[model samples]
Target: MERRRSSSCKMSLCKSASSSLGYVDSSMDVDCGSGWKYAPQVVLVKIYSFLNDTDRAIMARVCRNWSLAFEAGCLWRRRRFEMGGYRARTAEFQASGFAEKFGQHLRYLTISCNHPSLVTCKIFQRAMEAFLPKLQRRAKLKEFRFSRLEMDRYWRYEQLKEKLILTLTRFLRQQFCLRVLDLSYSQFYLSAGLRIIESVGLSCGHCLRRLIMEDIFHSRLTVYSGLRYKRAISRFTNLRTISLNYGYLSDDVMEILRGNLAGKLKTMRVRVYRSDPHGHRITKLAWNGLRRACPSLKVKFNFESIGFASDIIPILVAGIPLYELYIWTGFDDNSDWRLSSILNHVAVNFKDTLEICNFEFDNSTEMIDDALFRLTQSCVRLRSFITNAVLLISTIQNICELVEQRKLDPRTFHITACNLSDLEWAELAYLQEKYANMADERSIDFRLSSDLIVESRHAEF
Candidate 1:
């Protein structure tokens, strides 16, 4: 009996020692009773690193050490929260003091309010009022995205919009170190939008690199309102990329952008709908002025009408070097010749510098072929080419030859017109295999649409 009792006591001691080291006792089915406490704080953090925000919150309740580690701000670097669905969790987050503790470590924050009935403007305003104060303590935030998702119609209350804009402006004023600010697709009153732009320029102009204020125009505002907005946008002197959509791209807008963002802006995308007759047409003078201001700018034009293309394309070809060009436009049957001419011009002008070219047009089938072929012949430095134009088999062969000679990866080239014949496909396969062997790289992927093949004799250039 004495021997048995002594042996049992020895086993108990062994179990206790193992438990202290975070080892589970298989026989007793027990844990270390918070053995993470005994480990290094960093090791504890590493263990919790795999857990997401909600999981970490649950883990915080396990013990005080875990709570401290959870609140240490390491795991809260990137946080995305939806306003409506997570009200309970958000309340708990605030109650637990996690907002104040974790806000200091936040680098990327995206808050979205989508469900209209569930998340009203008042609710969002109140939430921001409470949350932004805590986040203001963060010395530097990399990206701040606030989006309100609604389809078909916009929030109608001007008062609510003003309140939301005020909250956002306050938040922006605090984030002096922000780099990317995307307020795209958010409805704001024209005056409020201008104020926000001005505020961002005043506060974050130094570090702000990418600013997207697309689709902020209100229908009630006049074309003159866009001019005012442009003046405000001009204040962002250090912006690298700026995108504006659904607003008039008038002469004034271009002149303001040129005067303010000269030598600083790199990429500019402007999109306007054709339904608005009040939309200001971009003039050649305005285009040339902008080109002279920023000599190397990649431009994207998404226009509903092709009437401006005749003027726009010539100016682009004549003015600054285009690094990348994306045009999505509709054309009448008569416009085929014009489209072809514009494309050939682009090919010749931007051959050396062009890296990405995407052209999507309605109608004009065979007109694009010759121009596309010319483009391929001249633009040997092309990295990504996507077009809806049908390429001749001979053209495909030339492209493949270029890919081989230039040692360009075939995967970067995409053509969305016409499947190749078995013979042509086999030849393409041979070229890909040969290139793969020569370069010692992965197999090349040449994307060809299977739907629109046409029979044409092979012609040599």
Candidate 2:
């Protein structure tokens, strides 16, 4: 009896040691606790990482131990809460303990309020007033993005909009090390936008790398508003990349940017919406000065029109290192604009720097053969030249020379906008056949859009 009792105590000790070491089966709970229940903190956090915030919450409900793992800061680094649906998810993200609990761990927070109902907008506005302040004390977000998909319809909500803007501005004022802030695809009142810009320049100047406020507008509210923006942006000590709408980018603003951003600025993405009617106001002198200051600067300028407004002037500037130029056509189009002059200007101005030029004009637009020839001849760095503008077989021959002279990489040169006649079709076929005969590695592969290929071609297309 004494020997049996001693063996039983020995077995109990062994069982306790196994349980403490977390070696029990993880598949199901046994007489002893499961291995997962005793899993290491780091191991449990790794498992929680695989689950999103919603999934992690569900996992936490399984047991108290999993809930502890869910609270791990590393698992809550990036979070996104929506107001309204994702495009219009639910009506709004309700106020909850989630922000208060994991606010300290948030590194990147994106809050999108796109197409919200009146009721949801009110709820979200109030919730944000209480919510974003909590983050300022503890969460030093690396990037914070807030965007709305609503159009000019929300301009009527003046009182509510002002409150929300104030809330966001207050949040920005307290930010310390924010890196990127994107407020594109949205509209803010003139005063509200200026306040936010001022806050960013004054508060986030130390560590901000990129500031994008594209399509954010209502700038024509006051003339002195330009000076306000200039003062605000000049204070941004370390801003690298900035994006602005046509209304925001003016000669005065660019001049200020030329002095302040100079060598520090890298990219400026500008968009011109036709509906805005206000043309891009940056002149050649200002752009050239900026170029001189920042030799490594690149500009990605896009022209977008909704076709409802009148045709806008060709907004491309000469002597600027325009890396990419896209002129997109919107819905119903009949523009009284000419492309020949613009092409000539581009051929001469952007010869050394032009890389991708997508001139997507409507079918009514015409292009001169000399303009095409000069563009292909001068801009040797031009890699992707996709346009809906008409072209002939002679221009096609000029494009082939880009690959033949080894001036361009044959594998990368993508050319569309081919409109040819029956005779020209035979010639193009001959050219394609000739290139096809070359070695597989050294062959000319011109990637063209199928939609732009039309059978009816003229000798003088």
Angstrom error at residue 217, model 2: 1.8
lDDT of prediction 2: 0.65
- Distance (Å) between predicted and true CA of 458, model 2? 22
Q: Which tens-of-lDDT digit does each residue in 1-461 have in candidate 2?
A: 64333223222222333233332222333322587767788888998788654455445544556656766788768877666644222323322344556678888988887656776667677777777877777788889888773424553566777788878888888888799998886567666777888888788776798988886655343322366777877787677898877667677877777887778889888777665645445578888998898888989878775221133334566667888777766533356455556667777778888887776655444455677667777777876766655566667667676666666543454544445555656676666555554424575455433233454542222
**Candidate 2 minimal-lDDT segment of 10 residues:** 87-96
Model 1 C-alpha lDDT versus the unseen true structure = 0.61
Off by over 4 Å in 2: 1-36, 61-65, 86-91, 117-120, 149-151, 219-225, 277-281, 306-315, 329-334, 368-370, 390-401, 410-446, 452-461
Residues 1-461, candidate 1, lDDT per residue (tens digit)?
A: 64333223222222333233332222343233656545566876887799754455445444545545654567667767666444634432342243455567788877776665434555666666667766776536889887663311445665666666777787788888888887766656656767877888888887799987666554434544455666666667787888776354567777877887888888987655544333345566777788788876777655445434455464453444466666656555455436777777777677776676777655444445677767777776667777655455566556666676764443466555444575665554455444455344544445544333444432210
Candidate no. 1 TM-score = 0.71
- Cα lDDT listed for each candidate: 0.61, 0.65
